[model samples]
Target: MNLIELSPEGNFESWEISRLKELRAEEFSKELGQSMLYENDEFRLWDITLKHKERLTFRRVVNDFSYTCITDGFGVIHLGNGKIQFGQFKKGDICSFNMKENEELILDVENTGLGILKFIVTELKLK
Candidate 1:
């Protein structure tokens, strides 16, 4: 998976950590995406779109989920704890993660590419 993982034990520079802490102080979304396109008893669907130089912070409660890239683009993944990463993805690329109980993932995403970066996230709610 192209997903980025962030932990205090991970290799992250001092400055990057500081910046992540700063971002954590700002507002962040509890939802997985910029917009909740749909939701029901079984799952929730979301849409996220980012123009060049756009950034968004999100607190993701870990669950089994998958997402599809809607456009080819590059971007920075910033964890709540301040780890920064640059990633490139194709238009059709898709990624998914399965979380056991008590696991959580949270981060900020910034679209650094010129092209619009978009994704559709499907989260399967636990029983």
Candidate 2:
């Protein structure tokens, strides 16, 4: 896989994939310890809590678009090609990425009690 470092110090090394594997759709929340905190026609929100050193394999389904906010602790997202740091995300301090359908990703949690909120778009309309 390709790796890119956007930071001058190159802190991206910690986010690299070591032994991650793609999770099947059936695994879903069961593997991530997640629960649907809220949902609506426009989007769905999920809340997840992870223990120290825990990880969740993520795969984007077709037409999926989502945002994640880390409420507690620190984490990382591995996009197979590269990675990004994930910590407390304030309003207006967001980052995003685009990917093809069924792309597999990895979420690594550091520090116990890692809390995350995921907002997923569900209103895709084709012209």
Top lDDT prediction, candidate number: 1
Q: Tens digit of lDDT per residue, candidate 1, span 11-126?
A: 45654555556655665566888899999998999998999998766666577888899999888886655566677878888888888898877766789899899999998899
lDDT of 2 by residue, 20-80 (tens): 3232223432222256666566555555555566655553333334554444344544443
- Among residues 3 or more apart in sequence or in different chains, the pairs in candidate 1 whose N, CA or C atoms overlap within 3 Å are none
Residue clash pairs of candidate 2: none
Candidate 1: where are CA atoms >4 Å away? Answer: 1-18, 22-28
For all predicted structures, in order, the TM-scores are 0.80, 0.44
Model 2 ranges off by over 4 Å? 1-33, 61-72, 82-127
lDDT of 2: 0.41
Report lDDT (Cα) of residue 2, candidate 2: 19
Error of 2 at 30 (Å): 12
